[model samples]
Target: MMTNSSKSTLSRGITALVFLALVFVPVIGSRAMVQDLFMVLTLLVLALNWNMLAGFAGLVSVGQQAFVGIGAYAMFGGVILWGWDPLPAILLGGVAAMFLSLPIAFFTFRLNGAYFAIGTWVSAEIVRLSVAQWKALGGGTGTSLPKGTTKDMFGVPQIKDLLGVSSSAAADALTYWLALGLAVVTLLAGYVFLRSRMGLGLQAIRDNVEAARSVGVDPLRLKALVFVLSAFGTGLCGALLFIQITRVSPDAAFSVVDWTAFVIFITVIGGIGTLPGPVVGVLVFYILQRVLADYGTVYLIVLGLIGIVIMLFARKGLWGMFTEKTGIELLPLRHKSLQRSER
Candidate 1:
């Protein structure tokens, strides 16, 4: 027997889960438009993780590509070196990134703002150089994984009937689903933590370190935890990206330009410090890309101009503008309830 409060919470959880499950139906069930949606979902997940780090934690880490490259490399290393399955390898990659983040955090945490950002970029460059020099893992030339490695690693039995995709496509689909799940989980985790006592401390610290410390918050520990988790999330995104390409090279794996640029753009364009902003931004950018994909360099120039214009005129990002104008929010990070609860 559940109390009314418990029942209400359960219902909401169920409803959210059902909605998530529905997102997959069109992809796995429908034939014409599944792949495109899956790709966009993957980008959305990337944007969400970036938002958690830069938007929420106020850590502008340019070397997020470090974790991304590490995760992709870990995928290959785990399967080839340890015979671990792909799914577990992906998780392993995330864990590895988290552990690695500790040392990086220790050093960079001493710096503030722009210096911290520069430190991250320098660290990623070091990683790229090291990987390029190392010959065992194929280095700058990159390496390839066996076909069906992702499916085989995850061990999804009845892949075809269950997913309604061919074996080759199934692997990609599964990776997309994994990214989608992580994005939702990351969002919920952020919301839950923000609502918890610790979240209050973090927010306080973000606002003013001296004030928060006077109130008994440990800024260092909180910042470290967020940095570690941010690395883990970025690494997980990288692993999914590796699954999509089925190949890894130092150049592509450590491609800061793509992962970092896309995520940073999405976070800034959507709304910094807001949960739903990055997701919305990703959708807008994806649509713009799809519509102008064939235009090549011209498309990129236009996007750059739009971004510049937005930065100068509307610095709050797209979601911030939407909130200011319409007051409608599909994802709320600051509040616990979907809508503002009146006392």
Candidate 2:
């Protein structure tokens, strides 16, 4: 009988080793490989935040793109208008998203279930349309970061000094490291939260809100906390994403599919409510993306079909199926006792 803490410690050790290895990936891997992994890490962060909110908090939001767009636009505005360093602006973008989420939460919290979902989506659309009219950011047309500004992104100079690389190479290295940090933070934070007192309360609410409230869980406060936290991570990811692209447009910044839809697909297919689920799901998604690249929109159709099959056959998701077959928890949020004596 190994304790959950022992298991978590061992897992953390292994994860640390893996993280160390990844830190060196940018050193040996080609620029393209780093770039591709950036996409994976970014999406994984988005998926993790969404999974935490929906899977743990029972707040299924479809309008997360609003925060994503706001984050990106904030970064762009900071760089273009405020003349701030890109790095600090990225942090500001997250702050801006957190602030935006407050009022939206106050409004959307009034609705429940499906109405909440739709209200969130409508809020996102309104934001996209409003951002589209800001002529300074090229209004509806879109704009790209000047080469000078891109090259001068804060930390670029320091990174160049340390790595002895060109500006473009330094940029990639810096962004790759940031992506790596964000992904790790998301995973650790989610796991920690799920193992916390609030995590227990949230799980109770997930199972039965009335029961949770009866026990003094304070469902509204817990839900609001989760919502604000989700906005922060999503907004940070959006800023990092647009930083890589070095350009922004209303459509691209506020893209529902890229920011929200794919995230949902990854979480749902991976096994909602499990830490390893999103990680495995993102890997599976990338594999499918590579294989189905030439098929155009058919890849999406196939995703839908797979989702339906999973729902019908294994409602808990692929990781859930795996867990049912073998009781292994890569990131354990649930405690178990094997023997009655131990119990």
For model 2, the superposed segments whose C-alpha errors exceed 4 Å read: 1-14, 336-343
Q: lDDT for model 1, please.
A: 0.76
What local lDDT does model 1 show for residue 319? Answer: 79
List pairs with backbone clashes in candidate 2. Answer: none
**Tens-digit lDDT track of model 1 for 1-343:** 6654465466568758966774665454654355566666666766777777777677888988888888888878887777778888888878877877887887788889999999988888887888787676787897888766766655455556675656766665666567668877877887787777878888888888899999999977877888888789878878777877789899888888787887777777777677777776787778788899998866667667767877899887887898677555544445466886663
| Cα lDDT of model 2 by residue, 252-295, tens digit | 99999999999988888998888888887888888899999999
TM-score of model 2 vs. true structure: 0.94
Q: Residue 192 of candidate 2: its Cα lDDT?
A: 88
Which TM-score value belongs to model 1?
Answer: 0.87
